[model samples]
Target: MTAARPGSREPGDQEQPGGGAGAAGAPRVPAPRGGRAPGPAAPGPGTVPAVRRGTAPRQRTGRERTGGRPGAAPGPEGDGRLTHQELMSLLGVWALDACSVQEAACVEAHLNDCARCADEALRLRDAVTLLGPPRSLDLDPQLRHGVLESALARRPAVRPVPGWAAPYDAEAARLDALLHDINADEWDIPVRVRWFAGEERAGRSLTVAQVLDHLVAMDGLLARAVGLPDPLGADAPADPLERTETRWRLVTAAGGDSGPARLVAARAWEEWREQSRELVRTAARRGGRTGEEMLPVSVCDPGIFPGLGAAAGPRIPLSDAYLNRAFACWTHAGDIADAVDYPYEAPLGAHLRLLVDLTARRLPGSIAGRRRAGLATTRARLTTAGAPGRTVHLEIEGAGGGDYWIPLDSPTAAVTRVAARDAVAQVALADVEFCRLAAGRQSPAEAAVAGQGDQAAISDVLSALTALSRL
Candidate 1:
């Protein structure tokens, strides 16, 4: 260092008490606390920092603490300068709050002096935000508005959905609401698609996104049947499961399955949503609106959209199809919920009632078919609408509960005698439980709660309900 000339102060020299005098000896006013203060004499050794009474001691800047060199920061090895590499290495540990007291002080002190390290530390902090543990299944706050907007856009909120399409509209919306709550990675989490197969509970494991793909593909079949565009083109299989495989393969070929899983799943989700809208719209339209329903498209599997498990059935009316698919939607939503360990509830009571009514209506057909297949013992006697000779009273007991007499002879009848006296056997089930049975979650043939009168007749009815269930 160059020697200072006599009577000339250095850049870092401090004013000391009773030392230098100004011209005419006028006293200088001291700066207030929290502002600049006079420093003690340059220390030879072991000098303690001075503390001002009644005021907090001033904190030294990184530069001042490191001997007044600009951009220098405090170091771990007391009084020694920290190398740029050493400071750079501590950034991540500091961001994570894992640094030791001295080490942290060193990194923090250096951060302000290095702009590159400062920027990197900021990015590290931003990454830390995603690592926080999740505590609830509460959906993103923005999801509610988006769903509401979509609903209002489809039709005025004040207009009641037609009864035939109401059940489907409600169920599809419920399932979509549930989907909104899933995390991005949860889309690929494994879930089992279950149904009663013959005498056992049969299940197939599928990722959450695959389930959406299945729903989309199947709903597309229904849309195509109603003159809406087919998502998988004209040659897609009419079988629900088969068409689902084709949809997945197309997604793979189009590179949808190879991208970030959330993006791929999102595409499938949008398609399913749009397919649902088209189906619902078709169900709502009448002869005045368009002649779209004139195009005949045959779809197999009564579990087509909502039932999703039946194979090779005659084409049903669009309204009835929506109700059937709606029930299946609820069942499959349950499947997805179970896979992700999320809580789900049965459909609204009125909606549940529609499912029960539809299931009851379809039961006669199921029994007739099963009898043909030799799975049912009931003797088939073909009869027209309202000509019921032998009938079982299906008395659903809870939410959406009512009495209905199912014809033993004819499956195509529009109405049958619901009289109590004509009933040979009566079966009662909770609305939710009955729907679950119909969804193939449990074997109806071995049901412990089959109600009243003839045991053989009750078993046939229960088995018929299970037969309607598919994935």
Candidate 2:
């Protein structure tokens, strides 16, 4: 939080200010030297430092005068020619630091005279105050261990699937192979065996089989939202009615050991899985005919509903759907696999790339809002795997606008192989910290790893993901 010295080399160009820079014509005084007492010195030409009566005098920067008169000439580096915005940013940074009340009062007085800076200062103050102090929470040691251990144990195995291939074909092939290895009559057997000997029997409240079913159901809801045909069959009842019936059946089937709500959720998931499979089939067929067509629907759009309503016109496109489904399935599959002791594979390169692109493109608005509010600076750095030794820089412009990208790389070329859909998946799965924040289970700062701090940056990323869900 040290103030930049006049004529001093600027910190790294990447450095962003918490508040705006100093106003034009303001002198850039050297920050106080370490614990040294002020000595008598005549006021230097063009200097204007604050002075106290009856005390050993310190030189003043001409800009320190309170007469509302113009100050002396700016330094050789144009020390005082900062825009109102820059001044606000600087003030914000200073306020966040440990400064004397008197010093803050000086800045406040200047801000009142400069209308533009005044508004920005207010916004910055609000953001800083709203973000508040970081909270401290004691986590259950066993739960913490379980969370980390699960992630570590299920490290994704990255096998490169062809970037040009359709994900549904690959998934179907895998499913077919799996089914071929087991009798059709035993399709229900895995569920039964899992029920008897799975995590549920080991004292966990939910079983691996239950988790799988739940994910399957959630996928169905996604498909329906996207306007795809129902997978359970065209005649399948509407989701609400079907869910109600499913719950009743589960309660009766389990002899009341399982609650009605839990059963309903499980049945809903079964339907969801069936729908997802059907969507895959449709996607594969379309690909066979057209090489690859974009699906004209988007599940992420806020307009889409669980059932009854058609997905809004102009779908998100088929290729995008492939990426999205792959990401969704892959991540959730990993979750189930971890719970059930199965191998989990990461998505292909194209899928991962798409995810990165989406994340970069959509998160700036949220960041901008936070920055304007003075919650944090607009500048943020993102570090990811594969793209090692490079950082993605994000700069927020306004409440919901800005630019983000890696330096020295073309956005189109860098993200050509990436899928927007997959980006959502990665955020949902691999970035569990973000997911927890999005789920409201933790705050942004608390989720950040120590020494790798940047809660504002992480929050921006989470905000983008949340936006997608709204979309």
Candidate achieving the largest TM-score: 1
How accurate locally is residue 449 in candidate 1, as Cα lDDT from 0 to 100?
67
Top lDDT hit: 1
- Tens digit of per-residue lDDT, candidate 2, span 1-471: 011112221001121222234667443332322122355454333332232222332333223322221332222245434344544545655334333333444454455356455555444533544454443222222343355448756883132222323444344333333323433233232221111111012112343334344344434444664467533334544343253345345544766434444354445444545655666655444443332444434333222211111322344434444554444444444344344334434333333344333334334333333344454433533434223221233332222223233221111123211321122111122344433232233343455522222344344444433433210
Each model's lDDT comes to 0.63, 0.37
TM for every model, in the order presented, reads 0.61, 0.34
Total clashing pairs for each candidate? 7, 36
Looking at candidate 2, the ten consecutive residues that score lowest on lDDT are: 193-202
Count of clashes in candidate 1: 7
Report per-prediction Cα RMSD to one decimal: 21.2, 27.0
